[model samples]
Target: MVIVGIEPTEQNEVQNHYNLFKLVRAPNLAPNQVAFRIPPNVNKLDIRDYLTHIYQIKVVDVRTMNYAAKRPVRKRDGAMRGKYVSKYKKAIVTLCDNFKYPPIPDKQSLDEYEDRAEITRMNFRRLRGWKPRPQRINMRKKERYEKFNDY
Candidate 1:
């Protein structure tokens, strides 16, 4: 996987849309903040560079954790059902404490954050052509017969 850092504009959009944020393991921020997944085998220095260039933020520190791919489960047919999980790394980027974001004046309470999360969940609710249910073959045939049987 590639170690590309998410852009600041994109990050702001995501934050406005998802009400979630990322943070590093620095001494300033909370320890269990948001985490970003990086591609496997990415170099530490490259990740540092990405954080600075793409996010346009001064990274005070960076750290990563790697996990091994998990094996697939056995199927009833004596064959493996699914492939092994992909291996990836998580990067924790600690930004300079002076970093500041535009305050969300519209969101005055925690409930507002929850509402924003729900909106993010429904981001693609009005997509143009995203049909989840396909037309059944027999149903199509029945409709054709109905349309012509008027004679």
Candidate 2:
């Protein structure tokens, strides 16, 4: 491997590794919006700054979300458990007006993006398979009224 400047050391290597982020492309997402996988502890302001300062990209907004590890189990009795999946964080960055992201040509990266997007779509609450039952309580139907007694 070719070293650019100083010889790479462990401390520098770890710091460099933290700079990694993957670009995710999806048909459902807006053109200006770019999705990427980042470290969980990273905040939105830092992400925005990273793109703008390091990558020279103008960012309008940065939205972040964390995905919990999917630990599968049996539906009937919840006894059988599958392999553990590590949780990860994803960032959806909105770029400045009319700025289009450079197309990623890496086939493997493209495929990974598709898989991540599909997983996210399935995990969405509105379209999820198992939905929580709506509460049928003493809620006002058409008019608002003060509670008469303890609920």
Candidate 3:
């Protein structure tokens, strides 16, 4: 029997492992550069190898920035106290080819999402004895209404 395409080799199997490389949007970056939120342990060499080997993309350069974790401060004493946010690393990778960012969702899709959220909220209220909390009143609208009532 003959097999089609490149056969799975031991090397391929070894390179098939998963690594966290989340693509992030950075409007300030150049067309050839892309930003990614990677694990703190991942280095520039690892990023270059991963992109070249897995995605078959030529990486020109990789720059990494480490962000320190933020600690919660006490409101009363103005002291640092509470759980710390996890530290993360951001990688700005420059590619040989230009990369175009994906388009944003239109207004119709946003309206549909709001409708679905409203339905879910109503369902939750029906199942549980949930009361709608009072929302903050807009000062402009309130003043306009007051002026109209005076007229």
Worst 10 residues of 2 by lDDT: 136-145
Candidate 2, 36-147: lDDT as tens digits? 8766777888787666655567898888899998877777775877877777788888888654556456775564664555456546744766553333112431122354
Residue 47 of model 2 has an lDDT of 80
- What TM-score does candidate 2 get on C-alpha atoms? 0.50
Candidate number of the best lDDT: 3
Candidate 3 lDDT over residue span 63-137, tens digit each: 999999887877777776888888989999999999876666586657466456656776788689876432412
Residue 150, candidate 3: how far off, in angstroms? 49
Model 3, TM vs. native: 0.56
After superposition, candidate 3 runs with Cα above 4 Å error: 1-18, 77-84, 105-151
lDDT of 1 by residue, 39-111 (tens): 6756678667655665565777777888788889998888887788877777776666554333435665555
Q: How many steric overlaps does candidate 3 have?
A: 0
* Model 1 lDDT at residue 124: 54
Among these predictions, the greatest TM-score belongs to 3
